[model samples]
Target: MSKELEKQGWVKRTTIDEPRLSEIVSEYKSLGYEVHLEPVHLEDVDAQCKKCYENQSDKIKTVYVRKRKQA
Candidate 1:
């Protein structure tokens, strides 16, 4: 899915906590971008970072954004 998104021009932005997710999403939308969010996946994390997200994955999200195609 990540590869598919990248192929479609969606750039991975950041993985963030839910607390600031809405604010960031709104910012991207306001800037005319199409934003997509996915729950953090185990494979998405580095071995060292996996521990931190193992139990908190549900509280975090992976952010991807792409410019809206002009009609």
Candidate 2:
């Protein structure tokens, strides 16, 4: 007999505020789903950069979410 393949799925999110993120994550948890947060940081940010590298190191913060374990 041949084996059957199972399908999988998940949710992805873009940059969001802390309170909203928490509310969404809590909802997912209540639904018995797994939540994953990915932090994205970039250097040499145009806005955050300083006059000289010695003065400051630029960085950008962003977040992504992934929800899994759905029926």
Candidate 3:
């Protein structure tokens, strides 16, 4: 019984959003398997992400989801 609570053996780990994680865990459990969730510390988030800088375009102005940018 105590062995069930032990954190040992293989696990699949990924940083997914909460909603998606819940969906995946629930889906797995529905198929009848124990799901173990553990937090992973992502300590090295890039402060100067060059990819982000490259992908971001100049901000576009819009209004009412179709109108125009406000002055």
User: Largest TM-score belongs to which candidate?
Assistant: 1
lDDT of 2 at 34: 69
lDDT (Cα atoms) of all candidates against the true structure: 0.89, 0.43, 0.40
Model 2: ten consecutive residues of lowest lDDT:
1-10
Model 2 local distance difference test score:
0.43
Q: After superposition, how far is residue 45 of candidate 1 from its true place, in Å?
A: 1.2
- What TM-scores do the predictions have? 0.85, 0.41, 0.41
**lDDT tens digits, residue span 32-51, model 3:** 55566543322322445433
Candidate 3 regions with alpha-carbon error over 4 angstroms: 1-7, 43-71
Best by lDDT: 1
Which regions in candidate 2 have their CA more than 4 angstroms from the true location?
A: 1-9, 40-71
49 in model 1: Cα distance from truth in Å?
A: 2.5
Task: List where candidate 1 sits over 4 angstroms from the true fold.
Answer: none
